[model samples]
Structures are given as C-alpha cells and as structure tokens.
Target: MRINILQHTPNEGPGSLLEWAQANGHQTFVYHPYHFGYLPTAEETDMLFILGGPMNPNTDLPWIKKERQLIQELLDKDAPMLGVCYGAQQIAKTLGCQISEAPAKEVGWAPVYRKSKIVPGLPEKLLVLHWHEDMFEIPKHADLLFSSNDVRNQGFIMNHRIVGLQFHLEPQADNVREMVVNDFPYIENSVLNQSAADILKTPVPEENKKTMFKILNYITGD
Candidate 1:
C-alpha cells in the first residue's frame, strides 16, 4: 500500500503511522505544506493520513483551504483517509460540519469510548492520548465512532474508509519532545493547556504495531 501523509506541522508529523508503514512494507511519502511545498494532487496517492497541527482547519490561510479541498476529493473518492486532531477538524469542515470549543479542553490521557465497528481493541472505552481545544460534530453521512469526557464527538468514520481520531496515537518519545519544543507556543499560560512537558510525565501506553496495522487495514482494505 502507498500512503500519502499530509504533515500539517514540523512537530506533529506522522508518528506511529510512518513506523508501521515502513515495517509492513508500505510506501510512505510526506508533504508538509509548512515546510516542503503545496498540497499534492488528489490522485497522487491511494491513502491519506493527515496529522495534527495547532492551526484551526477553518483558517483562511490558503494552504488550509487547499487541504480542505483535497480532503473533500478524497472523501468523494471513498479513499482511505485518517485525520488526527486538526486533521479531524478538516474532515468535519469539508463534510459540512463544524468544530467549536469543547466544553472543556481534554489534555492528557483520556478514555475514548468506542461506539461503532471502526476501531479494533476498543473496549466500551480505552485510554488514549488527547490534546485539543476543539471538538467536531459528526457529519450526517459519517458514522460516530467514539467519544470522551471533554468531547462527545471524539471519533467518526466516513464510508468506512475515512477515519477521524481526535486523539494522538503517535506520541512516541521523540515525537512528544518535538511537540513540546517546537509547538510550545500553543500551550501559553492557560490553566486549560496541556503540554508534552506534562504528558511525558505520564504517556499513553504505546499501541502495538499489530494493533495499529489492523487499524489501517480496517480503513484501507478493500
């Protein structure tokens, strides 16, 4: 399988996704609009994995809009797509939904309750890494996948192929450090803020590569 990853920012680039892709013999390419160049053409790849970012997906930045457009095309094609955090918001906006301030910011290990057939190894709930101030409303056409304490709409799936997880599954050691060191500005001084500094003290237990591969298989498998 070939996966095209839209790395939203330098720090939040594909984490476990990249490792699994390589270990499983899947080809992966990264195109970071903030670092590399423009977004790719819709036909450039078979699968799309959009990583997290501090920017709101609805921002008027030209690159943001381009990403939204590309996502819409992928959704139309029923291509396998996974959106994390801001990427999840992008999926919502492109699907004609909205993202707003969550009742409370979820920062740290959150128990995401899986409510659908989308995720494997999901209990009635399971602890996952979470860090976001925004929550998305599931698109009418998408299946609601999961929820958490601070956010009711934590995960959703579009046509079984497009999966959106608001939590972080790729926060390996170095990834967490990058987010803390490079993207620390988003933490500010707010009490609601959660940082890598805090999460490192307590991290989400890493998902086994097999579980992650199963997740991708569920999304990208024909």
Candidate 2:
C-alpha cells in the first residue's frame, strides 16, 4: 500500500505511523504542503495520514486551504484517511463543521476516555499527548470516539474510513522531544499544560503505539 503523510511543520512528523508502515511492508511518503505547496492526489494515496501542526484550519492560509481541499477530494472517494490535531480540525472544517477555541489550551499528557465502542481495541481510558488550542465540532454523521475533560471532542470517525484524533498518539520519545523543543512556546503555565521538563521526562507508553497501530489497521481494513 502507498501511504502518504501530509506534514504541516518540521517538528511534527509521522512517528509510530511510519514505523507501522515500514513494519507492514508498505511504501510511505511524506509531503510538506506548507513548505512546497504540493500534495498527493487521491489516486496516488492508498491511505492518507495528516499529522499535527501549530496552524489552525480556520485561517485563510493558502496551504491550509489547499490541504483541506485535498482532504475533501479524498473524502469524496471514501478514501481511508486519519487526521491528527490541526489536521483533524482541517478535516472537520472540510466537512462543514465549526472550529472554535477550546475551553483551555491542553498540552502534554492527558487522559481521553472512549465514548463509543465503534472502534475496537481503544481502551475505556487512555493517556495521550495533546497540544492544541482550537477544537473541532464533531462532523455531521460522524460517531464520537473519545473525549477529554478539557475538550469534548477528542476523536471521531466518519464513513468507517475517516478518523480524526485531537491528540498525539503517533509520537515516540524522540518525536515528543522534537515537539517539546520546537513548539515549546505553545505550552504555557496552565492546569492542563505541562512544563518542558515534565513533557520530555515522561516516557512514551507502549500502549500508545499499540493503540495507534490498531487504529491504522482498522482504518486501512487490515
């Protein structure tokens, strides 16, 4: 399978997702639409993974607009796709959902509870990495998957192929370090936000990687 990853920033890359692809013997490609303004077509993408970023989908930025269009195109074909954080907001916006400021900026490790049993293998409660200020309204006809105390919409699945997660489950230790270093400014002193040392010092749980692979497998019909 040809898996195309749309990365919006330098720090946020496909961490465990890339590992999952490699381990499964699938070809993987990464594109920086923010840097080059290029995106993979639906025909070329057997599976699409949109990573997190600092940007919001509500903005009028050209690259963000283009990426949303590409997401819409893929959705029209019922293509398998997973969007994380900002990318998830992009997907919601494309589906005519509203994007607004979250009650509070949630950063670092947080617990998200499974709201529905639509997606198997997801625990009733799981600690995942989060770094977002904006949240998306669940798209029409989509099933709500998970929710956190700070954010009601942590994840949703649509058409059984489109999945959106408002947290970071793909990041390994190294990926978390890069995110903490590069996007440190986004983290502030708040109840939900964590300090740089705390974020980096905490080990990446193995269950996070396992759940990530399960979601990938579920979306790709594995």
Candidate 3:
C-alpha cells in the first residue's frame, strides 16, 4: 500500500505508524507542510495519515484551508485515512463539524471507552496518551468509536474508511520525549494535565503499539 503522511511539525512525525507500515511492507511518503506549506495530490497516495500538531484549525491560515481541501479530495475518492489529535480536528472541520476548545486539557494517560460495537478489536476501556485541548463534534454519518469524560468524541470512524483519534496511540517512549521537549509549555499542572515526570513514567507504549496496529489494519482493510 502507498501511504502518505501529513506531518505538521518535526517532533510529531509518524511514530508507530511508520513502524507498522515498514513491518507490513507498505511504502510510506511524508509531507512536511510546516516547511513546504503544500501537500501533494491525493492520487499519489492510497492512504492518508494526518499527524497531530500544536496548530489550531479554526484560523485564517492559508495552509489550514489547503489541508482541508486535500482532505475533501481524498474523501471524495473514498481513500482510507486516519487523523490524530489536531489532524482529527482538521478532518472534523472538513466534514462540516466545528472544532471547540475542550473543557479541560487531557495531557496524560486517560481511559477511553468503546462507544460502539460496530468497530471491534479495541477494548472496552483503553488507557491511551492524551495531549490535545481541542475537540470536535462527531461528523454526520460517522460512528463514534471511543469517548472519555473530558472529550466525548474521542474517536470516530466515517464511512468505514476514515478514522479520527483524539488521543495519541502511536507515540513511543522516545516520541513522547521529543514531544515533551518541543511542546512542554502546554503542560500545566492542572487537574486535566499531567506533569512531565508522570507522563514519562506511564507504561503505555507497548500496549498502544499493539492497539495501533489493529486499528490501522482495520481501517486499511488489511
């Protein structure tokens, strides 16, 4: 499979997704919009993997608008796509849902429950990494896959091809370290945020890696 990754920042590159793609013998391509401010044509890739970032989608940014246009093009093609955190917000906005600031910023390990049985393979309760303060309404015709207390729309699967996850399931220990180094300022000692020390201590990498593989496989129809 030809998978294209849209990376918004340097630190938030495809972590476990790249690992999974390589292990499965799938070719991967990356587009760094922060550097280039452009994305390649949708026909060039079979699947689109949108990574998270510190940027908000509800702004007058030109790149954000272009990214949403690309997303709409891919959706028209019925291409398999996955969005994480900020990326998920982009997808939601393109699908005609508005993005809103979350009640509390969930920045550490949190429990997310499965909201539907149609999307199987995930557990009833998953302890995943949370790092975003923006949330989106579930798009029309999309099934909510996961939800938490702070974020009701933790994840959704649209048309059985597009998947959006509010939490980070692809981050490994090193990836988290890089994220903390680049985006540590967002982490305040609030009831919803986790300290850098506690975030580093969370043992969710291995389990998250396993779940990520399953989710990718299901989305890509492998």
Sort by TM-score, top down from the best: 2, 3, 1
User: What are the per-residue Cα lDDT tens digits for candidate 3 across 62-130?
Assistant: 888999999999999999899999999999999999999887788878888889876667778888888
Q: List the residue pairs that clash in candidate 3.
A: none
Q: Each candidate: what lDDT? A: 0.77, 0.90, 0.87
**The CA-based lDDT of model 2 is what?**
0.90
List residue ranges in candidate 3 displaced over 4 A.
none
Q: In candidate 2, which residue pairs get closer than 3 Å at backbone N, Cα or C atoms, i.e. clash?
A: none
Better of 1 and 3 by TM-score: 3
TM-score of every candidate relative to the true structure: 0.88, 0.97, 0.96
TM-score of 1: 0.88
Write candidate 1's Cα lDDT for 105-196 as tens digits. Answer: 66666677777865665556566777688878898888888888667888888776888878887667777777777766655543345565
Q: What is the lDDT of residue 109 in candidate 1?
A: 62
Preferred candidate (lDDT higher): 2 or 3: 2
